[model samples]
Target: MLSPRESATRERVSLDGLWRFALDPEGRGRSERWWTDELPGDVEVPVPASFNAVLPGRESHDHIGDVWYQRVVRVPRGWDGERIVLRLDAATHRAVVWVSDTQVAEHEGGYTPFEADISEQVRAGEPVRVTVVVNTELHWDSIPPGFVQELEDGRLLQQYFQDFFNYAGLNRSVWLYVTPRTHVDDVTVATTGIDGDTGTIDYRVAVAGDGGHPVRVVVRDAGGAEVARADGAEGTVRIEGVQPWRPGAGYLYTLEVAVLGADGEVVDVYPQPFGVRTVAVDGTRFLINGEPFYFTGFGKHEDFPVHGRGFDPAAMVHDFHLLRWIGANSFRTSHYPYDEAFLDYADRHGVVVMDETAAVGLNLDTGAGVLNQAGPMETYSDSTIDARTQETHRQAIRELIARDKNHPCVVLWSIANEPDTVSPAARPYFEPLVAETRRLDPTRPVAFANFLKATPDLDVISDLFDVLLLNRYYGWYVQTGDLVAAERLLEGELREWAERGKPIVMTEYGADTQPGLHSMLREPWSEEFQIDLLAMYHRVFDRIDAVVGEHIWNFADFATRAGISRVDGNKKGIFTRDRRPKSSAQALRQRWHGTEEPQPDTTRNVQQDPQQDLQGDVPQGVQQPARQA
Candidate 1:
């Protein structure tokens, strides 16, 4: 899963930009042999974008089933003998690739990279047709599972339990990269020990193809000066006066791994940037580099108006700047792993991340209006989510760790976001997944965001994780428009969780607010209500000793499935959908940076009625569903 880069013995070319696009609502693209010839439609779509938003009409925006993308690429003249790989950064849901008429590769996951060895299909210095068919369908066995229902009008409707809209297609980049036949396949680096001013780094290099090549490793500091060197496939290098990577102050060492030929010339080289930091959970504290760290950020989604879930570089940079502006330190890639570029930026800026798998929507009972309702059907049974779903979940965890384990910004591995941990069946289902995550990379702690239903008393699987991540909605979903009652309930729950003696992180807690809406009273959907709700949650967090982090439910308003619950989309963002700061954002900035707080309005005397029922005023049970990838 190493990102493609150019080296002395490597080359990379982007297979992005315009590609021939066609929609096959009846799933007839493959059977029609669309790869052998030009598509029937004359439409063109951009790669590294969700086809959903780029196409015209509402039919295209809400397309279901299969879509085809075809393009012609010229193989580099120098890549005659090298191993050429056609890597797709991501192909939503499922994808099948073909070189002209011959099928080459197939992949299932939508959030991780997959590649096909196209050296055999295309000759060097020649143009070859590359066709890809992407399917936007999910089943009970798929990660972030969904279903398709046929309407009376003979149109298929894609439905999912997850709160976010299912934006599908090539949402990331595609690349054609070359490496030596005997090249570096993977590299893993770990900070073994840190004693005073000295630090120890252990590294292992995996090489592919048949070659007994001598492996060389060199570590260079920020000034490009050699700090440490080691020979062979695996070894430890020590550095005196080591600079530890810390929050808001990042330091990186570049580990250049090279394989040498028989004549002592370089055969292949791959440079990996890593930071020397360690993460641990000590009693009721989450520690980074052995120092207790508190997280303050948001649970973000890769969403926008036009791009949908597509990757936008400018937006990414702006987001990191906003994180700094707000004086926040971390964010959870809420329900799925984000693009590698984000993690690279985090490494340079020192923003911690809770890397999560795409195992959202594991609970069968959660939907738009269902919060605390549990059905007779089991989420883990064969008739429902089942064992196949768990396998996909396990693979997602494996790929997530394999791709992100080397990044210092990722301090914790969240296996799932708000799954059915309240059910007895959840224990056996999640036990192996948690163990699998730790087994893959024991360097970091493991956790899953606890659903509101899986409270401190009912949860059966919190002990399996190192940290307890709670996504609570007190003032919003639970005690609507009642800040006093919400505070008491939130505090009572924190007290119950305190008995477990594990570090508790409120991964999500926020209220939806219309930007222009204002009210003297603490009314839901108003700017004042959002600020008041956050202040109440902050108060409870300060009183609890185990509370280590607070990431708001959203960074900005994101699109969700059309329903009565949504007014355009989710408005829980402290900032508007366009990134304009709402009143709550400034309030948070003041609180997190220890500045003067915004004074409450005391001109009007507001009557308090604890017995008031405000349920009818707000959207009934209109809360975010448990997360999925």
Candidate 2:
């Protein structure tokens, strides 16, 4: 689906409609033998929305192996001469595409876009049927090994259970493209640099057409006047002194790539809108347009409440609204990279992104207490991390950067999340990896989460990363005596590190929440307590002058299997996992962006109000102690 705000250049055959699903993989080819759902039955799941949320008996349902989705469409006679293509904005980990029993394409990864050229497979003026078979089970032979678990029934399930739920099937858009043989394959515009008055743009165009066909490239400002034009073999074209795109102010430019036939007839044209902002990391300082800015954002997960990780543009837009409303200026793609459209939306909507690689929760022996445990007395060093895991980390980072570098909103390249350096060899593992990132794109700063105090190896590794991000969960992890004491100790330590003149970013901080489930507002675990803790940090931000920025642990609550008692999981989010705003969220809205407005007096009122009437409903003898927040 294209943007509702703007019309698309190509009037696509609205292919995202009600479709049928057949259970049989073999019958996918046979036309009529397949099971067809009555119109408006459970078979037709909304495109870009999670199918797992709508399947029969889907409420809190668990495991599934395979499923089939079939859609029938009557081809327009006018589209007979043009090549028809089927585009799946996203599918699960693995899926095979069949149009009328003819297998056309297969795709891997539940996060990226894939296309199947069904031009030759579909018959014009006939009811064309497209079938998609999806497998959500994790196969060990795949690139990133999936997880396996034994259920209570003694049945083993092989699948990945990350922090968020994995919504299976085709969740993104299904578009049909009627294109001429000579069409634009891809068009990427790189904003090299932007000075005070002028912006520099480098256009890298990839096209598929008759060899030697001339292509015309045009750059237009938001007003639609052609500012720069280039005609060539559709290679790299550089345009200088163009207006630059800035954040918050919503400045955007349009780059049009037109494929011209011998007769100069416009065969196919692709227009991409981009912002040309200069992003840089100076030591530990993050800058856009040469101005230093603090990153106030959340660590966002890809999963939605019901859809799992499926694509819902509207749902994503709603997420963005919450982010903006909360006055967050940035977001970290925690644990894994998100859908491309999410990043694209961030670009235009003025939200900074820490485009992270999908490497998290590895190397650390969760069973151990120490930071790194390679030897009896040994601590974390470079060597303790797994050798096999290093390659997987590199591959995920490479793919993430290669795909997301063009986004202006992406300022930091988060190499990994909460990964441990269990051995001494781990230093060498990271040294070369960070160096390679610089080699790939030295434009953005490289950063990862740092374990505090436990390991001196952090200082050794700090040189490799541009920004040293620390995730301190002092209030939750180690009781550390008292909140004030812990905050003081952390502040002193941070000051000592800042005295080293190293750049620092507090990557994560916040207590868990049970969403309206707290015993005392004064205790650190309470929602009110978490709010007060963050409020204290607002003051610390000024004290730790060297700290360039900080992103709260998360914007909203997310699912985590490794949770603690009372809540069953970490309830650290300021908002509920379901995206409901907590009373503490209001406290943030006031102090966010350094606003001086007086925060609403919710603390006194909430504390004074009688405990909510969730009492008698408590299970048989289970005392409803205030949950964990």
Candidate 3:
């Protein structure tokens, strides 16, 4: 979705302070007409934050039903004839919005933006009561599926398979913006090609309303000097001596699109910042700008202490600074799409990203642990996660690509994380989703984070993707406390995957380490063990010719559900929850910043055989591994 912007023809106001909030455990807010009247026993909660962390008592932190947020807003008098819009950057799970007594919009899918044109709901200079109802319930039909159960004492319990806390409420910003009646609705910029000293950018501008008005596009450099111009809704602009955006060094060019009235007056303007970069996947090698690029970073989440999953500018800036200081160059949005403000920072700072959807925990069999006594379950059957769930997954893929397709730092699209791809039924379920991703945006490649249960020999859908993202936890999950056995098993698996001739990225591989817990000998849950486990994986990666990248399990510690497997929260982070560096942080800094030897170039002489095609029927009756979390 196009972000709300301010310009000569547009205006924006942030509704991001304190708002009256109350919990509706019985789900009676709608029946009682909470939109028309004031909320009962309301308390103040900050916008752009998760209410679960800031509220008091376990009853509020573990709330499993609907919540109400109410506030009053006055429309700007100067925005009389313009189209006024109320935009919510995100609302967890589901949301219904109303202005005074008129219901305006309802939306599903929590991680993307949604909006409503409220121009007709209220007068220009009048105050209107704005009410919002947000639901935190998850089901089999929702993305990142979960279930709500009731205990004998009548308290509701929320259960999910993913290893992260389900922080709910309005977790992003809200804005009131105005645009001209016929305004620039969307603009898409694509870097078509890069030749000797020139680069080509193709663009398409979509204008809303019945506007036969002329459209103009201009490209400007960092110094605000016009470099290229085009005079249509869709065309190409070429730049000579183009400065390419590279790793650790970024250069952004602003594309300003404007709609002009018949009287030669500007009606609306939108400036989009984009970088000129190209991403491709060759046999056994990932290429950025036609050169081999190795990914070195972590799979991160939008998490913090008090804010939960909320968007915090201070935390975001500090995380990026820490990434740069550690000599890392990329990260994957582990389970979902992050805030737009984080992507804007990545655009200017040149950090590669693997943009992902909220399709985590698709497998029902591998929920608890990987080595337990459980047989394979049919995860794609009609009774459980059925076609409705697949449709939700499809829509998530669509929205993710639509919102993030223009980002230059987003080099790859991760469709899901740790899905049940070993079952034969999974082949037909995910084949079209992968195809739909390519159909939407063919500029970048698509992948999914492979589960540990679906190994190289057993996975049925590994051949469908351009890149293979494996989330392995050998040292921690499997051969616990045995780095030698872990290294041996990891290398054996890597060799089996090398025959596929696809670029293999170790998307997740780390052990939980408690800060200040040290041992002279190798031991699990200690700082030394975490350091040694990573070093072992790096050794194996350098030996495998197809292994191209390594992103550790997490960048920092994060909250999860209460269980015996976790102490307070997952301690797999190289940095603590408060951004304090652990001992492993220095080890990673030494290895990545050239104090240690660089990884060998293993991309040479690795090509797929032309006769080997993965179009045949998937092998059946392969025994699945035991469960592991």
Q: Each candidate: what lDDT?
A: 0.85, 0.63, 0.86
Candidate 3 — what's its lDDT? Answer: 0.86
lDDT, candidate 3, 36-151, per-residue tens: 89999859899989999879788789898899999998888988888999999999988999999999999888899899999999778888889999999888899988777677
| Candidate achieving the largest lDDT | 3
Q: Weakest 10 consecutive residues, lDDT, candidate 2?
A: 616-625
lDDT (Cα, 0-100) at 125 in candidate 2: 74
Clashes of 3: 5
Per-residue lDDT tens digits of candidate 1, residues 188-223?
998777788888989999999876999999998878
Candidate 2: regions farther than 4 A off: 1-9, 13-44, 56-60, 139-145, 150-153, 158-161, 233-243, 367-403, 424-442, 450-463, 492-502, 518-521, 560-570, 598-629
TM-score of each: 0.93, 0.80, 0.93
Off by over 4 Å in 3: 368-377, 596-629
Please list all clashing residue pairs in model 3, or write none if there are none.
369-627, 369-628, 370-626, 370-627, 370-628
| Runs of candidate 1 exceeding 4 Å displacement | 368-377, 597-629
Model 2 misses residue 212 by how many Å? 0.7
Model 3 — TM-score against the truth? Answer: 0.93
RMSD values for the candidates in order, in angstroms, are 8.2, 8.9, 9.6
After the best TM-score superposition of candidate 2, give how far the Cα of residue 417 lies from its true spot, in angstroms.
Answer: 2.0
